[model samples]
Target: MIEDPQGTILALFAAFCRVGGCFLVLPGFSSARIAMQVRLFLAVAISMAVLPIMWDTIYPKVSGPTSTYIGIIAIETVIGGVIGLITRYYVLGLQFAGTVLTMMIGFTGPPSQDILEDAAENQLTNLISLTGLTVLFMMDFHHVVMRALVDSYTAMPMGGTFSPQGALISLTDALSQTFTIMLSLASPFILYGLLFNVAVGLVNKLAPQLPIYFISLPFLITGGMFLLYFGISSLLEIFANGFVPVFEGR
Candidate 1:
């Protein structure tokens, strides 16, 4: 049934370069917990599904010289990576905010194995990050990323000249926006930590003989935990709501 098997194969591989490249660094997909084989199969399946929709745009591009085809593959991979990095940076920003939140609340428990990765992380930080990621999955954030990947064909096109400058600018903009959003989310905790520490410092000054620092640790953690219990729902709600505008705006 295939009139041009070679061309079809080339087109599919071309599509795979982009989709697989995106998955290579995508958040949940690229998690260390996910096996490489599973990621590869999922990428291949998605590439196959996407190839037909993009057949007209992609097929013609592959019937070119070997050198040109190789160049296209590289460019497509970078384009896909840039797209993936945008989302990755945003999620990483949330993780950073979690770290800040834990510090502010004085929750300095020993680091434990991360729920999603091999690295050790603060227990509260892990909870916040995992909760935010779970909310993202529940809201189907991957669908948004896939939709952006599809639209990227229109925006970047196949075999077009790669723009490192433009790509860098996009990433920088994503970081900037992510920082602002994450900062706002962690502001209350930052303020709480500062105020709580200041009050504790004054108490220590008043009772120099007392082990105020030791005495205050429990209260600091308890207050922080209480704040988190009351505010976590709001934090995640804002975090999830902000993802769309930041991702699409970039």
Candidate 2:
């Protein structure tokens, strides 16, 4: 049944190198909460599934000499990592936006353990990031990533020379687009904080004897909370909608 067991194993490993590399840094899969063993098994399983689909293209590539095989492994890993990074960067951008939103709203509570990771984070930041990620999962974002992984074989064929310049450009463009989207999402809060602070400053000047700083902080927080309550749905909708275009375009 197996004419070339060695070649088949090599081809499967090659597929693993790419798929596992992507999972290494993928957002939800790479979370500290996920055990390494589980990730490894999942990667292996996906690699096995994908290998047959890509058999024609991948089988021929693995029959080369040892040195060539090693090179292909490295190049495939890098390509997968780059693809994973594009998604990671976009999600991290949402986290960064959450941080900005918290600061603007004066939600400077003590940092707590992050819901997804081990690091500490502000409560509001945690909420926004977690909510956005949940929405992404609900929308089946991983399916998109898988589809992209398959399409990548066409875009960056196996055993091709790795292009550092092209990889750098892709990363830079993802960051640029992510920044613009995050900024726009946080703009309303930024403006609210600015105007609220300016008005508070004037009131303090008018009532120099009073502790305006203390008095205004609660109002600032309340206003921000209300604004977030009203806008969060729309904010996440926009965030989820933008993911596909940014990921595909890059």
Candidate 3:
């Protein structure tokens, strides 16, 4: 093959560092379940797949004196990190919503070691995090993540540096949107828990000697599960819907 070895190696390494660094800390990929070595390989594989397609255009823009090229590479890495962080923070919204739901369901406890991810999470918190990730994969939302990485190069470009103020503003807007979505996603469970607890409290007041609160444990657990089952689909749909705009920052 007629190939420029130096150029190819340079392009490969640059792309690897940029993409790998982003994925190393990005949410789903960064989960405790994925081994660091596998994540590294996946990042390299992604960069390899993308470089051949993008390098023809990207290289020209980045071609310049050594100092200029280095600066461009740094800025591009930062832009990649920004995009990665947006998706990651969106996932955090699910975790935040889970935390709120756990509090409402009376599962408050000292942080315990989680089995699935081997992180410290209350039982309900772990369930929600795992479920959210499962739903993301099932809905092909990760494909959107790859697309966002590609689109970022177009929006931000290879050699150009975005204004720090503008990027900060975008980050702030993304966080706000994530918070709003989290509240909305958990609203059904939130309302249900509130009413259920209030009713239980009233009942307990009326029958102080009857151990009504103890009697309601089974009902509360059943009600919570049913409510979650009914609302889970909608929650996933809402998450899928919100995925794109945050990535595009539109």
**Cα lDDT listed for each candidate:** 0.93, 0.93, 0.77
> What is the per-residue lDDT of model 1 for residues 1-250, given as tens digits with 9 covering 90 to 100?
9999999999999999999889998888999998889999999999999999999999999999999999999999999999999999989999999999999988888999998788999988888888898899999999999989899999999989988999999999999999999999999999999999999999889988999888998999999899988999999999999999989997
Instruction: Report, for all candidates in order, the number of backbone clashes.
Output: 0, 0, 0
Model 1: lDDT of residue 247:
92
Cα TM-score per model: 0.98, 0.98, 0.85
Q: Which ten residues in a row have the lowest lDDT in candidate 2?
A: 123-132
Model 1: pairs clashing at backbone N, Cα or C within 3 Å? none
Runs off by more than 4 Å, candidate 2:
none
Collision pairs in model 2: none
Q: What is the per-residue lDDT of model 2 for residues 179-244, given as tens digits with 9 covering 90 to 100?
A: 999999999999999999999899988999999878889999999999999999999999999999
Give me the displacement of residue 45 in model 3, in angstroms.
Answer: 1.5
lDDT, candidate 3, residue 68? 80
